[model samples]
Target: MTWETGGKSEEPDGAGRRDPAPPPVGGILWSVAGDIRVLLTLPSALTMQVAHPAVGAGVDTYSVFRTDPWGRGERSLRSAQLWVYGGEEAAEEGRRLRRLHRTIQGTDTRGRPYHALMPANYAWVHATGFPVFRHASAYLQRRPYTPAEERQLYAEWLRVGRILGIHDRDMPQTLEEFWPYYRRMLAEELELTAVADELTSVDRPVPPPDRGPLALRLPLRLLWPVLFPPIARFRRFATIGLMPPDAREAIGLPWTDAQERRLRALGRVVRVVVPLLPERLRYLPLARRARARARRPG
Candidate 1:
């Protein structure tokens, strides 16, 4: 395949100082990243992200994943939506993320020093999403994206990477370059860090989701004992089941043939049902609003 700059900005920056442009309205990422269907596969993407030692270390040290898992996931999902659908807000969100991570440095379990902003670590986190979406689309999407669409999608993801402060040098610029890079990372860099283990472990201790109005919280707290087991089991299932098989093996995640069959069955239902929902229900609130604005006669 010929190398194509899918992520290159169409507009020239004369001063070479302008912030990277956000994914365009009606672009591949604008549609894919903002859809509610993405939630089905995001756990797997996140699990793959933390499989990198530096990222896992940073998350273990600084993230509230354990204590505030719901809030943490919600914020992450919202930030991702902004990157594709928040228009001008997308570039600001990216800068804000850099500022947030500026102070997040620590030593990994292996005693290697790591910083959250390290290009390789940050890029690896961004990179994991592409493959997960590609792989999981077979199950979650009504139809898997065609080869041309895949190229377009990867290119859009790279553009989003720039928004997150990742330079082109740190990420592959084309689909042809990306596959080799992705395989190399899987073969050489990724492993099951402690955070990855817990994320995919059924027995891991996860507190009841503790945010929301008191009225909502009280019932959820009371029902948590009954509600949490299925929720935890499903999280573990989705995280492992939706992961690319190569990455799953690289990270040493266990998966049975039976589980694969079940995951596929679930995906089929999601593909058929999710697309049938109306826009307000099918898309996240941020995406719903932005898509409406994009369609307005300007």
Candidate 2:
């Protein structure tokens, strides 16, 4: 995607001009992330990432991925998305992220050397994003991605990886090559880790439902405890269903007959309800802004 910004010199500190609508990581990347329920895919993505021995070891040692799991996940993902479409803000945050990971190299549980910045490790992290986008897009729309769109989506996401410093040589060049490589990694590289199990457990409280009018708040406060466990259970079940059976087994999240039944019913419910939302209401604010910016006349 050729960027054609006007001859520009106004960027602060001569940071230079960046395309507000960079094609590689725009559109589908923001659209997919904009889905409110995309949060469901987090445990699954994180589980897949940390299953790599080096990723697991690095995260366990230098990251707050466990102690402040939700906060850490939110900040890290926000940065990644910002890097894709937030222009200079993305660049600044990306640098901070690179600086943070600079010291995150050491040995894994097996005493093998590892570095978070290694192309291989960063690619492992980037690889997980594709499936998260795929599943969320599929579930929200009750539609599958066309082959062309899938490849396009992968291509776009690759630019995002590059922004975060993942090396091109370490990434699959096309969607055709990705699944096979992903499967091979699962067979050879993914392993169960205690942190992965803890993430999948999903026994924690979700964000509060309402923080507005006292009328709404009072009832939500009363009902939240009663409602949270079943909601969390369903989310856990849906996340487990997203992964292949072997991967689930590797992470020690057992799928049961009851979970399968509930998950299917939940999927049906989501398909029916989500599309009924007004298009404006269906996506996140960032997605709306990105879409609006993309459509503006050059």
Best lDDT among the predictions, by candidate number:
1
Q: Which stretches of candidate 2 lie over 4 Å from their true place?
A: 1-26, 202-228, 296-298
Angstrom error of the Cα, residue 122, model 2: value is 1.0
Best by TM-score: 1
* C-alpha lDDT of residue 76 in model 2: 58
- Give the TM-score of each candidate: 0.91, 0.78
lDDT of 2 by residue, 1-298 (tens): 0000111232232145452333343456666666656666666777788888888887777666545544555565566557555755655554455556666788877778987778777788778878766765555446788888888889887777666656578898888788898888888788887556655666754554543467787777788888778877766776677665667766567888877676667767877887688867876566567667877999
What are the lDDT scores of the predictions, listed in order? 0.82, 0.66
What is the C-alpha local distance difference test score of candidate 1?
0.82
After TM-score superposition, the amount by which residue 251's alpha carbon in candidate 1 deviates from its true location, in angstroms, is: 0.3
The superposed Cα distance between candidate 2 and the true structure at residue 114, in angstroms, equals: 1.2
TM-score between candidate 2 and the true structure: 0.78
**On residues 1-298, what C-alpha lDDT tens digit does candidate 1 reach at each position?**
0001111233322235577788777787787777888888888988898888878888887887777767677778778888888777878777667766776788976788988878888889889889998888888886788999999889888888988879999999999899999999999878999988988988887777666687888888888889988988998988898889999999999999999999989988998898899999999999999999998997
